[model samples]
Target: MSAPLLLILIAALAFLATHVLYEWLAKRLLIVSGAEYLVLGVLLGPQVTGLFPPSAVAAFEPILVLGIGWMGISAGTSLRLPRLVRIPSVTYRLSLVESLTTFALVAAGATSALAYGFQASYAAVMLPALTLGAIAVASTPAGLDVAFGLSARAGARRAAPVLRQIEVAHGMDAFVSIFAFGILIAAAHTQVPLMMRALTTTEWVVVTLGIGVVGGALFHLFLGSERSPDRLFISLGGAVILTSGAASYLQLSPTLAAFVMGIVLANSLRQPAPVDDVLRSGERPLYYVLLMLAGAAWAPGSNVVWWLVIMHYVVLRTIAKLWGTGIVTWINRAQAEVGLDWGRALMGQGRLTFALALDYSRRGLPYGDLIFTCAAVSVLFTEFFAARFVRSAVDPLLVPLEQLSMTLSATTEAVMESVTETMAQRFPALRKVDPDAKEHEHKGKR
Candidate 1:
């Protein structure tokens, strides 16, 4: 077999192994970190073991693109209008405030690092910063999923509210980052005249939306009245793959296009439930592959300036999340208490961040390697610390299930007693029979 094919087989096995390990660890520890898989990937990657070389990784780019496009679709479906309406206004406000603040702060920090710190050219500084900022706005869903899972197991009274905020925040951030990245990509085409460039970007966006609407409609029609899981998976998967390929061929944003398609499908009144199930079923394995490839592609420089840039990106991003969430909550008395735990809860970054970085790198953005490495390092940091923070923030709010059980038991017993007393008062013969009458009668019969 060819070396690239061999590498692909190894990666698939590794991905499966990681999934099993994650499940086992999650069950035992109540928290399973994805950082371990990344570390494993690094160990087996070109920079270390030289098992999966640059050539091998390059060969896998198409697969990565498909995975990323699917991710965008998954995220798009998350923005179901009905669900969004059900979310609290505070959750929406927090998501927007925190995401935008993170974007602005990261962009500023990156631009400064490039221009003043590293002394790069004007175009380099602006373009890299814009892409970096767009990428930094995302938070991984893994940490939130684990936190909420544990909270539910512990019967946390406040879990519902926290879960809602995190869900809304994560979902909104995904859309924001993808959309911003698309716009940035469009804006980066400077070969044409200013007027033509603006028109071109607008046209790309419109075309992207059009692709989504038409693709989604087609998907719905193809599924027809069938509810078979196999059929749903095949049809939806085929549509997404076609969409991804078309976007790549057109040099447009596959992520944005897939996202738009997802939105269309999700909002369609006649959309089948199996469609969602199919997407979710395929998302996990694809996510694992995406992250592993991201790790394999990791290459860091020895420059102090780059290190400084990474640190600046990390620190400023944190401050942005806190500051944004703080100001929003402080201004709104209703969410004041929630803001206290918001920033820490949102610190986790994972697959989506890596995917965005990978996308940026594939686009040949300036300083793309540095951005990817920084993102990888930052994701590791957040994964470690964020889990602890989520636990800490949620632990205090937990209402143990034992307490709930006891309360329920007491209420049930009281209700039974009240019913028995009412029956006894209404039926004098019943009261005369007494609680032991049946026992006495059985003894006599024996």
Candidate 2:
């Protein structure tokens, strides 16, 4: 009956609706262009909606933070210990190298823009660069999902070395982005002595590893004797969400913690793990809200924002893509039999970029608006090329399957033709080759 109660109910529905809409739209647009959906969020957010008013948005902030934590914890759980130990040097090397490359390129552009008479302040220039750098550290799972799905549709088994390496690179990016943001946030606010102390790169990494170990260990002990069909995933999901939420509250990086959790669970847990279903359940909801929040808050149409967007999103992102892929070419040569031509498969900017931009905005970085604009643009452009590159890279693998299907179809047609011909030649005689006739012939010979 009260206006306050009515508003609360409406906001609840809005949150729920946003998630469902995001998932539905993601499926549809991913087929069209995944990057488009990123902007769609900006369209729905306050700058567009006038729906997510300051008060409404501020109220939702806590929930958004919680969602972020959930995402991080979930991500941490992806880092399997076995996978890490199995390829230690390559994993760490690729991640560090790529993160730095992306950071430098994006930062240089932002710095240049500032020098060229842009309105960005000193903090804005440095902060945006760091934010973009953090984004650069993220890999687009949506792009990967699209690529992998197309590969499967085309009947590919295990992905080629290039694709595999890209996936690993993405994982590394996610790991680095998490901690990088933590350090960035801490550094930006020198007054927060505690934040600075806790977020030293080393401390950030240790905390991440610690969270994973502790979370995974606790989950294992809790679920060791469980026999339910979905025990592995349910238990793991609970731990990830809890760990991520708790870490966020503590001002730690939930993304790193979640990633570490994922890694530990995959290695330490048994086969037929339940993580797939659990992850699926959480992913749709979290991603939907995340994008909407980013979109609703997006500020478009300013010339300064436009200029910044072009510099960072278009030029810098392009450089990063080319450079990142080129690095992959070398890494692939050193470690595997697969060769990746940077010209073909390097369009990978997705949710990770959005997340980093959001992280910076949340921290009051002056370049938040610019970062959002750039990230939204990058997602769009990358999605367009990602589908093409993925299809090209995966096409070769599908050719044999295509050939096999055609061969089988042709053989069947031939067999049917032969059967028809034989029937036409001896329809009546077919009945005459009888059991009694063979017996009679044998008796006569005897």
Candidate 3:
């Protein structure tokens, strides 16, 4: 898209962010994923309005990489291994059980189903399997105030143990899924140089890990001693760009490399909040772009009926999750610390799922579009039913949802500041009763 088109897109997004109907649909109805934009993107895509063609969608790939890298960094920073070890062993066990089972069942089912039924190449069959497997291991921690909404600290006190276990499990799941997805990107992806083509899959995987480790180390070295939030924001952006550029060139997962960089910085930084806050502040714009691209990629043809494959994909995931939860429940049947149908609590797939989805589209696989389409459908389906399903297992709990991106917050602040300064210059006396001074005076008066 040209600059004008980009501006129009931005204007439309700004409108959607504040629109009352969108508010009702997002906050009041759906479980709180940015999936509404994705569906909207699909509607305006080539399959529907043809406004966003494949070429137009491709134009946004660089931005897509940046967005995925941001998500990976967010995931990595969320974990502090020092604190992670403190969680009860039971949490790890349940998380592992559920994640592993879900991955095994869903991946195997998807691969087998596609191979037996669809007419795609081996790469196509394996691509979706790996993507789904990585995604399967993920669970969103959004709805809890400690997460996005579980704010009645005192009221939810009884659920504290529950919350901790779930959160730890969630972090672990994200870690594994991202790591595995990165590996899949390295191993199965086919964009190697002719000279490096002789290298084995194991070598590629090792290179992927190496990129992440080195990127992480370099990030810290470059960010040394910078404590200002503004500086941190700039450094973070630069790191994301560098790591993403390298990954894109190597045809590896940029998010995975950024994830490792985040982990390294996370462990090293005494004060990570400045950087984390800055990164998180920009999440909305990234998510909106990614969600739309993921949506716009779905122009399905008659080949094996893409919708049918998507349905099958969702069903397998649902069964795998439920079955995985059943196993966990049975294992913990004797323990009170464990909740029932823990998988239900984990039903929120959130951004990571979409992250992997969007990343898969970059691989140039034959059925890559189909994989992303399935993911968008899954995300939407999960977002719609997330809270409903959670209510079934835990009445006080809502499903995980990423809070809507505050895209306009910074712009709004800047505008307000500019207006205030302009007014202050116009009326010099107005500066005498500065808000800070007035607050101080009021406090003194009180």
Candidate 4:
């Protein structure tokens, strides 16, 4: 085998191993620090080890982009229309609120970092551009998955129900973030042709929606239930691979395109079993790939970048989230269900930071190294804080089940008595027939 082939094989295995370790560790740690794995990958990457050199890593750039695109699409597929339509008004309102809050926080944080110490004018322009683009758009469904799984394990069904809600919320947020990014990139490009505006504007939206509809229809017609579980799963993966490649070749947004495919497949208003089966098979692998790429993409920088990162990650971003979340709540009246302050506090940054930082570096933006440093750290902190907040929510389903098993025996008995009385009152003849007898029967069944 050629040296290049050997190196590629070694790097691929190393990347996979790092991701597996991170997944294992993320489950065990109280802090849930998965972002560290990505940092580790960078430290061990060719940039440092002279194993897989800069040129070799550069070769993976297209893969990284396609992987990210698939990640977004897969994330979107999870947003079944039923959940989305559950609180259409609420979803729309909260999505706008979450997106704006994230954007404002990232922008302010980026600007403040520049004001204080980011001396390089080139770095300043790129850092805010990259960070703002990232912070505004990120939503970590993986973190939310951890929250839901834990809640299920702890017997908090009520809390677990919130999982679907959060998924829908994150999906909408991702769409908005990506859409906003498309606009931002368009505006930033000086030589953008007038004709390309259509590509960036409503045309993009129409194409995305159209792709989704077609994909969904095809899934509904042929692949819905005819194939075996394994084949059905592989078919979906094949579709994503094709769509991603096509999008990449066309210089179109693969993330948007792939997501539309998922949305289309899942939203066909048909049986959800096929869609569910496909997700069951392919979702985890895709997630692992996306996350590993994310970690591999992190290119650490010098002291200047580290200092700026600290400033933006903690101070500026935090202030922006608090302010933006609060204002959004006030305007949308979402405080009735989700506390204004709490929700604002929980709108922490993550994946989007990595995506945008990679974009900055790939595009050869000046001082892009500093942007990656700041983004990686901010994602680390945000994951920690956001996971904690989500874990703390009162899941009504989870509560009742746990109480029935352990903490609420007495209350359960009292509730049983009250229910008996109400049933007796509502059904006089049945009460006469045997209220006490029925109570004994119920207790015996339990």
Candidate 5:
């Protein structure tokens, strides 16, 4: 059997087992965004194993690239610009401030740490730090769902007045993170195509954006605002493949380009987006695939310098997250009641970090291993703290379950009573002609 093909069969089987194991692991945590898969991958990977070697794993890059590209597209589609325009301006300001500040603080600290403490060339120190900065900026958009159990339209949101602000920040923070990473690519390492060797950084950016627009147009033309569910999925897959393939050819970031395509579709498409439905339905397998790739690629750096950098990364990220978000929460405090420990609301890291790491760490860049390790470690730690941080956030807001149940019951009763009274007042004949209507409805429930 061919080496890469054999490796794939092994990973495919391991991935099935990982999915089952991950479901079991997820039960222990309040929120698990596939970090465990990375851990399992590490255990099964060449670093620890009887598993596929680095050469074989490297051969699998094409598949991982498309997966991460889809992630970028997925994030972009989440933004519906017309609707976001109506959210309070304060939210926009806060998301901007928080995202930028966190990026700046973490990037600066990480660079200083690596340049001074770790022994690496200029590129090695700068690149990973900057990647971490981008990873640090996006607070997971799902954080609210994890925190308030917002999945079912729970009442916790009514108690936490800052949810609108929290949500806007979460949704928009990825823009700042991804754009910063894209600029990093253009400025630091983007390759010169033979025909485009003289283009400046700004021109390079234009080229990448053009690629995204083209990809989106391809998707737009193919779907034409309508397609069956199955075809819609195929069309999106094809568009992402083409966009990512072009970016890969140019040594530009596929994630960034795919993101641009997603933005194009989200804003310009006039009908309900089947793109989202397809992505949602297919997201789990994507996560697992990336998880296996990330795990196999993960190699723990075995020196004090690397460990110190990891430690510095976690500390700096936490301080940056708290300090940046705290400052904004303070500013927003005067504007709204903001009833929870608002600083921690947006600290959870999600798939965007994984997506970026997958795009970067697989490229044989300087210290790519450490960057992937940091991304995994960062994700693992933040998810833990984010769930823990909910205690400080929701503890004060908690109501007794029985009491809440009674309150819901009373509210339902009061609403029904008001409706009946309004109907009787509007039509005196409703009571006279159908005197048993209310009684019959009540009795039917039994």
Candidate 6:
């Protein structure tokens, strides 16, 4: 194999090794210290250790887009209308209020800071802030996943309701963020005239949705009465890859287009099981690769202004999450307790934020580096603390029950073993006739 291919192979192997270590010894590390993998990418990347050259990284662009497209589809699955209808109305109300509040506050603050505080030009101020706002709206699913695990272990009765609310809120916020970012990206093109530009954003959205729906239909048709797992994987992957390529060609959001395709498959078809299975199986590896690439490309300069912008962005976004959640909880008294603590759940940032930041950097937007760096830093802080806080909050509720469950499990196992031993001693003839008699009898008894 050639040198570039060799480097790519090495990176893949490294990812596998790191993933194993992460899974076996440090599952929380995967969620909290995700940026460390990115740092590894940087070390192996062109700018640092030069294991992978810039040209090689550029060549891997298709894979990056594919990773992003997969993330979008995963996000899309959460927004199925049927699922949304089942969610509580209060969940919907709280999700909308909290997401919109964050978006509005971040946009307003970033725009003002960039435009007046930094004396940035028109595009520089408005575009970056708008993009940041969209990114700011995303809360990591990892936090909720961890929370669910804790709730399950603890058997907290109230945990399910809160988890459901967070899930809906995070899903809705991601959907809105992708849509808003698509429009912002369309509007960023200064070459287009005002009249045409007004139509451009709509046109892109239409084109994206159109591609997604068409792709979904094709996938559905291909998978008809097919049960082979390989075929299902290939078909779903092909549709997403094609849709992502088309979106990229049109300067639209591949993630959004793929998301639309997922939504289409989820809502428009009868048998979405195959598609869902394929997506779940592939999401993790793609997500890890995407983060590593983001780290490789990250190059935040040590400018005081940029640092200040990042700090302000984080502070304002946090305030928005807390304040908005508080207000919504106050209004909806039924779920007031859930609403109050919901903001803590929203602290983590994950795939969507990194995906958007990578897209911004790829687009070469003004102050893009600053925005991307801020996002990276934000993810590190939020993912680390959010996971800890959610675990701490929910674990306490579960400790007593968990201990009781463990004690009961231990007692039952010991009693069974003792009974088996007693039976073996009582019927030595049975053990002689069938050496495994006690084990088999124990299994039967259980």
Instruction: Estimate the lDDT of model 2.
Output: 0.60
154-253 in candidate 5: lDDT tens per residue?
Answer: 5444334466666666667788888878877776664565674666777767778899999998788778577588988887888888998898787777
Candidate 6 has an lDDT of 0.74
State the lDDT of candidate 6 residue by residue for 146-179, as single tens digits: 4454344544543456656667778878988888
Candidate 3 structure quality by residue, lDDT tens digits, 358-442: 7877677556777777777777777656655544655433322112224467678899999999999999977656688889999
lDDT digits (tens) for residues 255-281 of candidate 2? 656666666666766752455446655
The RMSD (Cα, Å) of candidate 3 is: 13.3
Model 3: residues with Cα > 4 Å off, grouped in runs: 1-4, 11-30, 119-124, 145-159, 194-197, 302-305, 396-446
lDDT of 6 at 420: 82
Query: Model 3 Cα displacement at 114 (Å)?
Result: 0.8
> RMSD in angstroms, all models?
3.8, 6.7, 13.3, 6.7, 5.4, 7.5
lDDT of 5 at 164: 62
Candidate 1 per-residue lDDT over residues 1-446, each given as its tens digit:
35667556756765675568666755566564666657766776887987767676788877888887888888888778876787778778878888998999999988888887777776768978988898889887766555555344543643456556766788888989989987776666434344444456777777777877788788877665668888777777788888876776666677888888898888883654667777867776776677677677777798988888898899998887766676776777645335455666777787678777777777776888888888888877886555566666544444354477789999999999999999989987777565588899989999
Specify the highest-TM-score model's number: 1
The local distance difference test score of each candidate is: 0.75, 0.60, 0.70, 0.57, 0.72, 0.74
Q: Lowest summed lDDT over 10 consecutive residues: which window, candidate 5?
A: 334-343
Better of 5 and 6 by TM-score: 5
Task: Go through the candidates in order and give the clash count of each.
Answer: 0, 24, 4, 11, 0, 1
Cα error, candidate 3, residue 300 (Å): 2.8
- Model 4, residue 302: what's the lDDT? 62
